[model samples]
Target: MLSAVPRFAKIAAVVVLAAAASLATFDIADARRAGSSGFGSRGMRTFDTPAITRTAPTQAAPIDRTMTPRPQQQPAAQPPLGAQQRPGFFGGFGGSMIGGLIAGGLLGMMLGHGFGGGFGFLGLLLQIGLIMLAISFAMRFFANRQRTQYAGPGASYNNSAMNNANASPRPSFSIPSIGGGTAASQKARQANDEIGLQQADLDRFEHLLTEIQSAYGAEDYATLRRLTTPEAMSYLAEEFGENATHGVRNSVSDVRLLQGDIAEAWREGDSEYATLAMRYSSIDAVVDRATGKLVDGDDRNPSETTELWTFVRKPGSDWVLSAIQGTGTH
Candidate 1:
C-alpha cells in the first residue's frame, strides 16, 4: 500500500506538470490595440482574403466578427463509383493492423502484462518507437516514389517556369512626403494606380492615426465617434468599457508614423475603401485609474506597431476609420 501511494503521487505530479505545459503552450499576451484580429465590415470584400503586400506579407486573420454573411463553399466532387480510393495515414488494411497493434500494446500496459503480453513499460516504449520508425520509413518511401514519377522529361523546365511565375514583382507604393505639398503630390501619384488616392487622402490617414490614438487614450467618445464609423466606434467604446471595468486606462501618446503603404484600395458602390499597412511608434501603456501608476508598457520609451487600418468614405465625404487589423505584433 505504501509503494502504491508513492507511485500514485508520481503519476499525479506528472499529470499536473502535463496540464501546466499545455496551459503554457496556449497562453497569449493581450494588448491594448484596437483590434488584434480582423473584425468589422469591408463591404463585399469582407469575406475575401486581402491581397498580400510588401508591408504585410503574411495572411491577415479572417474577419471573424462582421455583419456580412460568408458564402458557403461548394462541396468537393465525389470520386467515381468503384474507383480505387487512396488510403490515408491511418486507413485501409495496413492502418487497421497498425492501429490494432497499438491498441493491443496499450491494453497490455494497462493490464500489467506489457506489449504482446510480456516485457512491461520498456516493451511498450520499444513497440511505440518501432511503430513510429515504420511510419517514417513508409512515408519517405511513398514520397520518393511520387517524386520519381513526377521527375519526367520536362520536369526541370516546368519547375523553372513555376519559380519564374511565382517570382513576379510586387507593386511598390511611394511613401508620402510629410509637410511638403509638392513631394506629396508626386508620391501620391506614384501610389497604387487602381486606388486613385490623392496626397490629401494620405495626409488624412496619417492625421487620423495620431488623432484616433489621442482620442482613445483620453477616452474622448465624441472625438472617437467623429473620426471612426459607427461600427468601429462601438468596438472602441466596448474596449473603453472593459478598461473601466478592470480599473485601468490605456494611455497612448507621442504617435509617429514610421512607414506606411496602401495594401489595397477599391470602390464598393457609393463608398470607397482603402486598407493601408502602417508601422508607427507610440508611447502606449495602461495605468491604474485610481492611483495613476503604470500597469503595463513603457511610459518613457515608444513602441513600434505594424497594423492594417481600413478607411472608408463616400463622394464629397471625409474618410473615417472602418476596421483595424493587427499584423500579429504586440
Candidate 2:
C-alpha cells in the first residue's frame, strides 16, 4: 500500500506539474493578446505534438459562409511590419533563466521526492514545491522576454549607439614596451610610473572583469547583460545559444589578468573613452549537455589558455568588454 501510494503520488505530481505549466503558458498567451505586441512580436508557433498539431489550425478563418455574407466578412487584423513568429516554449526556454531554474529545481526535487524520506508526505510537498518553482521561473522568463522585446529606452539599442559613436576604426594606441626577453618583449610594456587610473575607475573595471569571469564560469548570461556591452553580450548569447543546440559548453576555468595597459584615454563631447588592453589565461572546456561528460577533441582536464581583451570606458561609467582574442597553450 505504501509503495502504491508513492507511485500514485508520483503520477499525481507529474499531472499537477503539467497542469501548472499549461496554466502558465495560457497566461502568457492571454498576456500577449492583451498587449499591443504579442510574443516578442512573433505570433503563435507550430506545435510539435502530433495530436495538438492535427487539431490546431495553421491560420484562423471564419467558419460561417452563408450566415455571414462573404462581402460582409471582416478581414483579419495584420501583424505589425517585420514581425516574426515566436518559437515554442522549449525554444524560448532552452537558453534562458527559466530553463536553468526548471532543470535545477526539478532535478533536485525529483531526487528528494523519489528516493529520500521513503516517499512520504514530505516527498509530496517537495513535488508541489518543484511545480510552483517551475511556474515562477516560467513567469519570470516570460516577463524578461517581454522586457527585452518591448521595453522603452532599450539598453541594447542605447549601447549600440554608444558603440558606434565611441568605437574606433583602428587601434587607437599601442602599449609601451615591457622590458624582457623575446616572449615578454612581445607583450605590451608598462610604464615605470602609474598609468593615471582613478580609484573609482579601477574599482569599476575590476568589478566588471570579475563579473565577466563569474558569468563565463557559470554560463549565466542574464548577469552578463549588465557586465558586458551590447556587442559582447550579443556574442556571448550567440555562443551560448549554439552551445545549447550543439550540446557542448565552452567553459573558462582560470582567468589570470597578467598585465593591463590603458592604451588610450580621451574624451568626446559628453562621454569619456578609454581603451585598455588586458592579458589573461583560461581553461576552455567542452562537455556534453545531457551527460555532462567531456567530449572528444577537447581536453578531459582544464587546459591552459591566454586571452587579450580590450575594454572601453566612459566617464563615471561602466566598463564594457569591447574585444577579445584568445589562444590556447597546449
Candidate 3:
C-alpha cells in the first residue's frame, strides 16, 4: 500500500503537468494565430497606438485637387460582378475532417508498431501525442496555403511596386489666421471654419473605414498594407505567417462605422496628430482555407459585437489607423 501511494502520486503529478502543458500550448497557439501569416501563405502587418500631438494648419484644397486626378490615373480593379458570394462553408469542415483522419491514421500506425509492449496503455498515450503533433502541423500547413489563396495572387506587387506608382504627390493648403478682424469676427470665422473642417474630416475618416472593412471582407490584405501603420503591418504579417502553417483565415463579415468623433488634432513639433473614436464591427473567422473549416469566430464579427480603432494624422499627412482596441470583447 505504501509503495502504491508513491506511484499514484507520481502518476497524478504527471497528469497535472500534462494538462498544464496542453493549456500553455493552446495559449501560445492563440497568440501565434494572431501573428501568423494566415493559412501559411500570407505575411504579417504591424499595429501601432495613438499618441498625443499639437495643431497645424488644415490643408483641404490640395487634397481635393490631388484626389480628382488620382481616380482617373488608374482603372478600378473590379471583382467579377458575381464574385461576391461567400465561399462554401463546408469547404472548411471537409478540410478539418481530412486533417482529423490523417492524424488518426498516424496514431494507428504508431500504436501498431509495438509502441507499447503489445500496444497497451502506454502505447496508446504515445500514439495520442503523435497524432496531436501531426494534426498541429497539418493545420498549420493547410492554414497557410488557404490564406494565400484568399489573399489573392502576388499581393506583394500591390504593396511595393504598384503602390508607389499609385501614390499621388502630397497635397498642401494654407489656413487663414484668426487675426485682424474686429477680433469678434475673427473668432467667429475661426470657429466656423473649425466646425466645417471637422465635419469634412469625419466624412473622410468614414470613407476610409468603409474601404478597409470591404478590403478585409474580400481578404485583401494588400489594401491593408498601404493603409495601416507600420506597427499594425508587422503584427499582421507575423499573424499571417503563423496562421498559414495551420490553414487558418480571418473573414470579417461586416464593419459598421457606428461613430466617428474627433479626439484631438494638432502638431507637437514637426509631427501632427489626429485622434478619433471609430466604433465598428470586424466579423471574422479562423478557417481551413482549402476545406473552409471554421476554427473560431472574431469577437467583432457578430452584429452585436463592436471594436474601436484609432487613426493618426500628421501635419501635412494622410490619416492612417494606429490602434485597434477590443471594446470589452477580447
Candidate 4:
C-alpha cells in the first residue's frame, strides 16, 4: 500500500495537467469566431428558435447574452369555480391501511422482529408480497371510481357528437405548386415575403458581411459601432479585449459570400428583423501581437464558415448587425 501511494499521486497529477491543457486549447478555438455561441438580441424573438435554411440546416445556437427581456409564460389553467377537488392517493382509507402496514413493519424492525413480527426472512418476503397485492387492489378501486364518476347520461351523447363531427368529410382546396425552384429557394422566398425583403436589402447584407469582417480584423471600433447595434458591438469588443490580453490579434480579410438565404424575417412593432443564413469564405488567422508572427490558422488560404446573422432596422434606417450565431464548422 505504501509503494502504491506514489503511483496514485503521479497518475492524479498527470490527469490534472492533461485537463488543463485541453481547456487552454478549447479557449483558443472558441475565440476564433464570435466567442463560440450566439450573443446579442433579436428583439422579442431573442429566445425563439430561427427557421433552418440552406446555408444553416442545423439548429443555430441559442443567444446566451442579450439585453432583451424573455417573454413571460401564460399561467396554468385553474379548476372550475365551485367544483370539488379530487382527493389524492394518500387521502383515502386504502392509503391509511398501507401507511399502517409500513409503520408496523418499521416498528417490528426496531423491536428485533426482522420486519415480520419475529417470523424472520421468509415472513419478510411474505409481507412484501401482501403489500404489493394491497397496492394493486387500491389502484383498481380508484380507477373504477373515476370511471364511474364520468360515465353519466350526457357522456354517450357527447361522444357520439364528437364522432359525427370527426366522421364528416371536410372540403379541401388545392394550392398551385411553385414551378422549377429548389425547396431552399421556395422557403427563402416565403421568409422574404414575410418582411418584404428587397434585392437591395440582400445586396446590402452581403456588403455588410465583408465590411464587418474587415472592420473587426483592423480593430476599427468606429466602423464596427456604425455597422452593429450597441449590444452586438459590446460582445465583439469583449472578444477583441480578450485577444489583446492573450498577446494575440485576429486577422480577417477577403470575405466573400458563397451562398446565403433568408432564414427568417419578421416585424415586431416598428422594428423589422431579418435573420440570414450565410456561407462565406474569409482569410482568418491569429498572430502574435508583439512580433506580428502567425500563431494559429491559415492566413494564405481563405476558410469557409456558415453562420446565421440577424439584422435589424427601423422605418427609414439602414439595417445593422443585431446577432451572430454559428452553425458549427460547416
Candidate 5:
C-alpha cells in the first residue's frame, strides 16, 4: 500500500507539471479595445438633422415640421435707418440752414461790415450769428408748414420693415414646428429640440444600450440582429467579421450610462426616431481567439465615452438601435 501511494503521488506531480507547461506555452494575443467595443454613430445625427428626412427630426427646430409649435419670429427690429426713416422738417431745414449761412457770409463780404471794417474778425462772427438766427426762424416756419401738411391724427410713424428681422431665436424646448416647409427652411432653426423624453423612455434606452454592447462583445449576432435594425446589424456583422479575420474578439462588461440626453425625437411617417447623447462607461477587453489572451482593452479599467445613438421604432413597436453618432450632435 505504501509503494502504491508513492506511485500515485508521482503520477499526480507529473500531471500538474504538464498542465503548468501547457499553460505557459499557450499563445496570448494582444488586447485592442479600450475597455469597450468603441463608440457607435451610424444612423442620423442631431442639431443638424435638417435636410436629412430619413432620420428623426430635431425638436424646436424652426426648420423641420414636427408636432411642436413653430416659434414665432422675434419682433421686427428697427432698421439702421430709423432716423433717416422719420420725415424731415418741412422745406429741408438742413438745406435752409446751409443756404442762409452761405448767403449771409457773402452779403457780409460785399457790405464790408465784417472782416474788412467795423467789428473786424469779431464783426464777422456777429454777422454769422445773425445769419444763423435767421435760419432758425426759417426752420421754425418750415416746421410749422410740415406739421400742418401732415395733420390728420396723432403723429404716426409707418415703418416698412415692421416685421422683418432676418431671423429670430428658435426654441430649444419641445415645441413642434408648424408644417413641413422646404427642407432648407429648417436649416436655420434653433439649436435645441423640444425633447419631451420621459423617464420610462430613458430607462428603456439605457437598458438597451448596455444590452446591445454586451451582445456585440459576446459575438452574439442573433441578439444583435434582434436588437438592431437590419442595416445596423449588417454593419455590426461586418465589424465582427473584420475582427474575426484578425483573430480578435471584444469582451465587454460592466456597462453603465454616465449620462444621457435627447437631441431630438419626432415621428417620420409612422415610425418614431429618438436621437440620444449618451455618456457611458464600460470595462472591455479584446482577446485573441487562439490563445484567449488579451489583445487590447483593459478589462479592469473603465472607459468613458460620449456617443450619439439613434433609436427607431414603428408605432406600437419596440425601439431598436438604428445609428451611432458623435457626441453633442444636437
Candidate 6:
C-alpha cells in the first residue's frame, strides 16, 4: 500500500507542472505595438513648436504656408498710347496745326516781298491772319482737354473756377497708439489676459496626454481622429493597420502624469500653439488581438517615459494635438 501511494503522488506532481507550463505559454503570446506615440507622424520636432514643422516623420518638404500673411498684388500699369484719334474739323489736328502754321508763314513771306516789298501786302496780311487763327484753335483744344480730365464729364468751362473751389477734402484718420501712458496700460492688461490663456493651455495638454494614450490602447481610431490633427491621425491609422495585419494589439492603462513643463507657446494668425515636455508612467503591453494574450512588456510593470507634445487651438475652439516626439524609455 505504501509503494502504490508514492507512484500516485509522482503522477500528480507531473500533472501540476504541465498545467503551470501551459498557463505561462498562454501569458507569453501578445500583439505588437497597437499604436504607441499616439501614432503621430510629425517629424522629430522635439522642442520645435513652430507652425512650419514637417507634418509627417522623415518628410523633407516645406509645411503648409496658409497661416502666413502675404502682401496684396498691385494692379499692372497701363501701356502708353503712341497716337491720338481726331474728330470733326479738328480731328488729328496737332499735326495739321503745325503744318498749316509753316505753310502760312511761307505764303506770307512770298506775298509780302512781291506786293508790298515785304511790308503790308493784302495777300501777306491774309496769310498772317490764317496762321494766327490756327494757333488760337490749337491752344483752345489743349485747354479744353485739360479741363475735361480734371473737372470730369459734362463739366463746363463757364464754372471751371467754381468746380475747383468745391473740391472735396483729402481723407483723414486717427490711429490708436500703443506707446503713450494710456496705451502702455492697455498693453499691460493684454499681457495679463495672455497669462490666463496659457494656464488653460497647460490644463488641456495634461488632459490630452492621458486621453490620447487610452484611446490608443483601446484602438479607438475615431476618437484619435477627433483629438489629433489630420496628419497625426493618418499616422496613427497606419499603425493600427500594421497591427491589424500582424494580428496584434497594444494595451495601455494607469496613465499617470509625473511632471510637465511648457517649452514654448505662441500665436500664429488666429490660432495658438503650445509645446510641452512631459514625464509620465503607464502600463503598456502588446497582446494577440485574437486571443488577448500578453506578447511583450510585463503586464505587472508600469513604464516611465518622457515626450514632447504640441497642441494648437483657435479662438473659441478646443485644443487639438498637432505633434508628438519621444525620448528613450526610463
Top candidate by lDDT? 4
Residues 130-242, candidate 2, lDDT per residue (tens digit)? 75666668667877887888666588756655564454422211212222233332222222112344534534554566568868757887888776666667767877898
Query: What's the ranking of the predictions by lDDT, best on top?
Result: 4, 1, 5, 6, 2, 3
How far in Å is the alpha carbon of 76 misplaced in model 6?
Answer: 36
Worst 10 residues of 2 by lDDT: 37-46
Per-model clash counts, in order, read 0, 2, 60, 0, 25, 8
* lDDT (Cα, tens digit) per residue for candidate 3, span 1-330: 334333423443355347447845886777644521211100111122222111111111111101112223367577797786554332667567755554454344343432233555566456556655655676567767767777644587445534433544222111221112243233223331322234345555666777776775556778977777666656656666777777776666665555333433444455444444344545667777788767787534455333334455556777766555433322
- Candidate 2 segments exceeding 4 Å error: 1-196, 296-304, 326-330
Question: After aligning candidate 1 to the native by TM-score, how far in Å is the CA of 157 from where it should be?
Answer: 20
- The lDDT per prediction is 0.72, 0.48, 0.47, 0.74, 0.56, 0.55
Decide which is better by lDDT, 2 or 6: 6
lDDT tens digits by residue: candidate 6, 1-330: 334333323443344345435545543453223223333422333323222111111112222222223345588655568654344334456657655655544443333332123444444445445544655566567767766665743466435534433543111111122112343333323331232333344456667988999999999988998898887777777778998899998899888777554444566678776655567789998899999899888677899876667677778989898876654345
Stretches > 4 Å off in candidate 6: 1-197
Residue 1, candidate 3: alpha-carbon lDDT: 36
In the range 8-63, model 4's lDDT, one tens digit per residue, is 33443344345446645764676665434799998888897776655565667888
Q: lDDT of model 5 at residue 197?
A: 45
| Better-scoring candidate (TM-score), 2 or 3 | 3
Better of 1 and 4 by TM-score: 1
TM-scores of the candidates are 0.69, 0.37, 0.40, 0.58, 0.44, 0.44
- Candidate 6's C-alpha lDDT? 0.55
Q: Which ranges in model 5 have alpha carbons more than 4 Å from their true place? A: 1-195, 327-330
lDDT of 5 by residue, 1-330 (tens): 334333323443344345435444443322231122222332233224322211222221221211234446689668685367654653366676565546554544544432224555555545545554555576667778878776654344222122222233232222121112233224323323443445456567878989999998889988998998876787788878998999998888888776554556766667677866566789888999889898887878898766657788886888898776533222
Candidate 5 vs candidate 6, lDDT winner: 5
**lDDT, residue 13, candidate 3:** 35
